[model samples]
Target: MSEVPQARRTCRRCVLPESPPDITMDSEGLCSVCLEAQSSKPQPEEELLESDFTRLLGKHRGKQKHDCLVMCSGGKDSTASLYYMRKRYHLNPLAFTFDHGFETEGALRNVHKAVEKLDVDFLFYRSTFMRDMFAKIVTSGSGAILCHLCSMWYMQVALDIAARYDIPLVIAGWTKGQSAHQGTPSNGAGQAGNREYASMSEATRRFLATLKQDPKYRDFPQSMEEVLKRARRRHKAIVLSPHWFLDTHPDEYVELIRRELDWEYPDLSYPAKSTNCSLNFLAMHLSLKHYGYTHYHVEQSKLIRANQQTREEALKDLEFNCPREFLASLAGRLGIELPE
Candidate 1:
């Protein structure tokens, strides 16, 4: 019988393993990420008080047919955001969901149920506009981060939609991990600038730069920074997430959405219980193949640093739980076969 390979050791405080260049383990078995986080001085940050969120909502509410555009992914965080916009803040929100042909049925169902229950206008855009780009990433072996590229495309779409509808504020369900690194709390939503994300963002920017050389993708934004800059010049809209200000935990709101909006967790996900698109499994697999970890590891590590989630919980969620067959099926969709 073949000997089983030993599992790679991870940091004592976070889920990041000994991935070199970007991440490394020290003599104490703690990762460089953990050490840096430990030694860093806490900078003064403007606290995003709940009152501030309420005030922002008040400023935009009742100004137009739809006060805000809520990007609902049918996940717990986004569903809760939709619920709060309608029930808590009493704002007429236009719930928008974009499906790139890889969205899971569970997510779509969750969105349908939430909008029906909230009695809000819903916009579901399903297209294959991204399929060719996604296929290129796999076929050409360009180590481009799928989620980053997808976000660029979708963010541009969201900004255009907001402009078309005359919506002033666009809302997302991004947790603290996603936007906590913005220099100022006011620039929270859709911004990633934390130390942990530095290396990954650099990789994404480099990959996107190469992607822009293609005639088809020539118009694609060179980086997320470019995306935000262009959006600002064209149509100024403040993007915000309620999770940044609200003290509610995922468990707290997951249960609430389950009971109130009839939301059910997806049957399977790479990161255990996440409601990510089906293509995420392929993205995670490829990320782990090239880099030692996926962006989920970065996100979870941030949560661990914030004490929002224990290291053990993050490790559990970050475990490779998806079956090999599922990965093969997803890869087949892109006309690629996984090597044994």
Candidate 2:
């Protein structure tokens, strides 16, 4: 009889295993998650905990027409932001959502539902151009590189949409977990203070280059000249992250919105195909299978350190709930090639 290969052990924190996922161990036999918990990015010794929360509403506080262009995904974060802005801050925002072709029926319905309920002027940008671009990127079988393409495609589209609308403030629900090192809050504060053009500088260009260094996006030149040219065409657009404020207790804020907006808790809110977007699971799976951590692990870890979620909750989310059957079907829908 042939000797069967023994299954390797996985990280105690996440779903990553020791086999092909390549999780490294320290002298203590601890994984990276243990290290991350011990040494997270330092937070301010004192976070200005908001009481009224209206005092913290910089993105929505203005009488200017078309005050903000919100990239809402109809998830808890974006939906909470919208409710806060419209009901609490009373800002006039032009809501925008990118239809990435893989948005589940729930997400689509909720997008339209939220927009209608808010009664705001909403724009849905469905790009066959980007659909083909992403399809080609994924089908090319460039492992772990397609993530950059996905991010860049959305950002470029958002910029184009914001520019066309002449919207000054581009609001998003990006939590501080995703923005701490990315310089988003820094850029947002600068824009709020009206110091300089909301354009990418040499340093910013270099940072963006790191983000797009995946093989799929590697050949593309990261020219500040071209980025600047594009920025020049737009009115001053400052991307403000509402999620930054909710970094400590995002679910608390979401619950508040749930009550205020009378929002129904869908069956697939966080870990399933119900509330959260479905396409995210596929990306999460790829990130986990290749990098040994889902995007949610890195993202949620930051939030956990920031006190948004408990370590237990973060660990649960990092367990990688990729519905294998559903993912194969999604590949077909998005024209991504499937292995026989």
- Per model, how many backbone clashes are there? 0, 2
Model 2: residues with Cα > 4 Å off, grouped in runs:
1-23, 32-64, 145-147, 180-229, 246-248, 265-276, 304-308
> By summed lDDT, which 10 consecutive residues of candidate 1 come out lowest?
180-189
Native-vs-model 1 lDDT?
A: 0.79
lDDT of 2 by residue, 1-340 (tens): 1111235454454433343323455655555554555685653553434443445456445646677788877776777777666766788888888766765566666667777788888988775444554455345543333343445555666667777867766777765534312322132333332111122122234444553656545544344233334665765576666656544466587677566655555555335322555555665455444444443444554555456567676656445544567767656767776443
Error of 1 at 91 (Å): 0.3
Scored by CA lDDT, what does every candidate get?
0.79, 0.54
Clashing pairs in 1: none
Q: Which candidate achieves the best lDDT against the true structure?
A: 1
Q: How does residue 117 of candidate 1 score in lDDT? A: 91
Residue 230's lDDT within candidate 1 is 81
Task: Please state the error at residue 315 of candidate 1 in Å.
Answer: 1.5
